[model samples]
Target: MSSIIKLCSSLSSRYNPRLIVSRFTVQPRLCSSVKPSSGPSSSSDHDLKASHKVDNFERKILVWTGKYKSVDEVPKMVSQDTMERARNRMRIKIANYMMAATVVGCLIMVYSGKKAAERGESVSKQNLDWHKSYQAKADKTEKDYASKFEHMAREGAEAAKAN
Candidate 1:
């Protein structure tokens, strides 16, 4: 029993999770004895070098979370040329959208005009058929009235000749 307990304790100590994790984790180091840089140029140069070292992956991991030791280590979020190109792309996309919309609107207008013309032609044909029927009725009524007047005139002339 004693030997077994000793073996367990040794194994636990050797495989301590905290110690294993700490060995792999990189801890931030504090510089207490180092003096500040003497000149502004030297400090600025150090900052420039640090900033240049911050690539996409470093910037993503270190800068946003404030994990960097100094503010100078953070790089610019985006370059000027990249920003300009993005703006130009946006403008071009908007122009393309507007052009497509204009073309669709013109197509719809043309289709509507064609439909309206077709409807107008049908309506005109119906109106012409109705006018022709009305004109035939009017001509028949006129002929009936003229024949009645001529019969009355013949009767009067025959009566005058007999008297």
Candidate 2:
């Protein structure tokens, strides 16, 4: 029963996510003092040896795989070739868009011109009718004024003769 309990406990620990994560995580040591197993001199010497070993281990583990110390030390993610390709693609896209816009503008202008042409004939006919009416009224007014002037001149001539 004791062996079974131990096996179960070990299996639980192995399957536990938190225990697995904590086992792999490196915890920082606050101090490098080794607990004295013997005399003070021996303990001091042991502490120094242990600290040196820890430093070497840390230095080995902290080595950069890419020879980069930080993000700033890393090379640019985008290559010049890729940037140039993207620039060319963007230029092509802009050219296509400009061509499409020009076509649409031309189509709009053509449609408006057709509509204007359809309306122009009716507008010109209405203008001709208006001008004819105006001219007829002007001619009648001028004849009326001329007859009034002729009657006044005849009256003045008769008055001069009588005098």
Find the candidate with the highest lDDT and give its number: 1
Query: Which stretch of 10 consecutive residues in model 1 shows the poorest summed lDDT?
Result: 26-35
Off by over 4 Å in 1: 1-76, 121-163
lDDT of each: 0.63, 0.59
Output the TM-score of candidate 1.
0.29
lDDT of 2 by residue, 67-116 (tens): 33544533333334433444566667668999999999999988987898
Model 2 CA deviation exceeding 4 Å by range: 1-76, 121-163
Query: Candidate 2, 100: how far from true, in Å?
Result: 0.6
Q: What is the lDDT of residue 160 in candidate 2?
A: 100
Q: Each model's TM-score, in the order given?
A: 0.29, 0.29
Measured with C-alpha atoms, the lDDT of residue 51 in candidate 2 is 30
> Please, what are the lDDT tens digits per residue for candidate 1 over residues 12-89?
567552222337794443222356676756656555444333356544444334445554665564444434444566
For residue 104, model 1's alpha carbon misses the true position, in angstroms, by 1.1
